[model samples]
Target: MDANHLINTLFPQGAEIDFDGEFFTGTGQVGDKIVAVLGTQGGVYIGVELAHRMAGIVLDTVRNHPGRPILLLVDTKGQRPSRRDELLGINGYMAHLAKCLDLARRQGHRTIGLVWSQAVSGGFLASSLLADECYALPDAEVRVMNLPAMSRVTKIPLERLEALSLDNPVFAPGVENYRRMGAIRDFWQGDLAACLATALDSPTGPDRRRAHGLEREGRLMAYKVAERVRHDPV
Candidate 1:
């Protein structure tokens, strides 16, 4: 969906959003509530500067907006893969951005992520995946890595990965696959304003993605394994 159309749909009361082609940050009204909005656009590659800038917005929202809910609009390719970024510690910057969002959640600001377009790899991880509840638009694309790339990284062979993806949503790349894995809480469709309102009014709770994964049968053992680890007498 076009960014402007999405903003208008979600914030029918109008918003004060600003988009500079790649990055956008602003505030929008959802009913009687105001939400802090921050996100990337056009499948931009997230680098040190972009990560730092996003983190600053989250931190500022926490400090200035008190308990206002935050909305993350994710659409990125991944971290910028370059020697300079590596030398500058791109991982640290991404982690900082994730931590800033975590801080906002802890500080009583409801954090919601909407995957309106593409969300891949570390870019998805540090943004949408960190939200209290992450939802995807009907046509959103979400993937950690493509099969050929995963094959190269894991040496699992493209054929084997392809066969695995048939039954295991974990090996697949799509909004449905992600929804099955519980990475995406749900899909937002129909009246978008209503969807946003409903999401905002939803109760906050502990992360349930693992449990959802089990129920959906996409990751049968993840929740059980996590439970075992949590109860381990180490």
Candidate 2:
């Protein structure tokens, strides 16, 4: 099915999915197996909500049934770039999401994030960052920033960025760069089921890239974040 069809199938318009305005949104079983759909348009509030709901689901599932894998599908431009979102304590909300993901890890729930389209900036951090494994579609236009936007924001000329993007996969926009960064595990090139199965089959542990040498690459901050998590379990 096409992307729109896929989204409609997953999150039907009439479905009574629970949502707390900007903080959380989802529809799934009460325990064990859970599937969440997060959009990119929402801001930090959405991230906060996503975390709150996931924690609730995890807690409920753990108290009742054996922990099951959580499937997450992400298609977002990024977190809300709004003054109100920042003023409403975005950092605290982000921290809450981090804590919820930590709970999932500590409890041994396989957290998998799938990027079907755009996964960027704070939106990526709020959800995708916490995954034990992450996968992106080959057609996904993923990136930290689009060239023109990056140029405008950084005050760098567009031609210079174009030059850099050609030589530096780090500056380009695509799924391949993230793979080189080790931030992504598998690229959904053909068979979606097989790719999902492989990601599900991955052994649980700290990402090696998160541990050593690769730190000096594009994901320097991610590396440092991983180290901090290692030093303190929480």
Candidate 3:
């Protein structure tokens, strides 16, 4: 969904969100709780500058308003392919951004991620997947490297991986498949404001996603492996 439609759905009373043609940043109320809103559009490839800006946004919100919810709207194609960025340690900048969001979580600010469009590669990893509670719209496209790229990297036949991905939710590319893999916890619908409000109130810290994935038969071995690790102490 476009930002305007999304804003209308979520903030009927008009959220104080400012949208440039490129990206959006602002704060608004979800139910009775005020939240920090950060989003991107047009499938922009996020670079180091954008990543650091996102970090700043979270850091400012956490410093000024502790315990407030932070909402992330992830719509990025991937990381910007720049040789200079690699030289300048873009990886470190992304890590810093992740640290900022983690700091928000540590400070008791609930973080939520909503994906209605592209959620791919380093862009998604630096933000959306880091949320305390993650969800996706039905139309959201969520995936890592596409099958062809995976084949190229692993030197496996694309046809083989494609067939496997059809049966294995973890290998597939869809919102429901991510939910199945326990990455995205739920699907979102109904009243947007009320839904966000409920999400804020019901912060599932240390949730049962790994177990849910196994129960749903999507990520079969993850929970068992974790349990095994837990039981067999060093």
Candidate 4:
């Protein structure tokens, strides 16, 4: 009936489940439509696998429920940080998620994204990026790259990176920065109940990719990458 009860039913604490290796199912209704929330704050490998499972759920739901909308709650930190996951086709796992999202979209279901917390890199790409519409809590720490991790990977000193982030929001981490990047359309400024109400009330077919400036960002970057890919198809 309430959100807490709903969440508990979906994710009962002390329940033993292989979060990284299996599909967990919970059912609720979006108006007349039965909605399912798949996955957790688990790492990337599990997130990608969950995405595929979500897709399968969507297909089956559509067949049974006909035209109900699907809402996806995203709170991933990225793919699994494991050497084996990397070696054993991480790219393929991501592709599986992508294919599932495409299938959901083509079937005409209103696929929506709710980012409750950290949504970074490949995990974000696998789920939220494919949604028809997306929203995040105002306090949601959304980013393509976390600053510390980015600093380490980029080999930039943390202090200098922090200074650069003040001016370069792209490298900064926060909900507002994601808004600027066009990564998400709305922020949940109101309370959870109000926000969920708004989400249910809001029209789902809003032009997302273009409005978020992400399409432009990708188009501009596409040329540089395209040239290199054309030169070397590897």
Q: List all candidate RMSDs to the true structure.
A: 1.5, 6.1, 1.7, 6.5
Off by over 4 Å in 2: 1-51, 58-64, 210-234
Ranking by lDDT: 1, 3, 4, 2
Highest lDDT scorer: 1
TM-score of each: 0.95, 0.71, 0.93, 0.72
Candidate 4 lDDT over residue span 157-218, tens digit each: 99998997775656778877666666677776535544554566677664455444545352
Ranking of models by TM-score: 1, 3, 4, 2
Q: Which candidate do you rate higher for TM-score, 1 or 4?
A: 1
Against the hidden true structure, what lDDT does model 3 obtain? 0.85
**Highest TM-score scorer:** 1
Candidate 2, 204-228: lDDT as tens digits = 8876654332643645566777668
Q: lDDT for each of the candidates? A: 0.91, 0.62, 0.85, 0.62
The parts of candidate 3 lying over 4 Å away from their true place are none
lDDT of 4: 0.62
Residue 12, model 2: Cα distance from true site in angstroms: 17
Evaluate candidate 3 by giving its C-alpha RMSD to the native, one decimal.
1.7
In candidate 4, stretches whose alpha carbon ends up further than 4 angstroms from where it belongs are 1-24, 30-33, 42-51, 204-207, 214-234
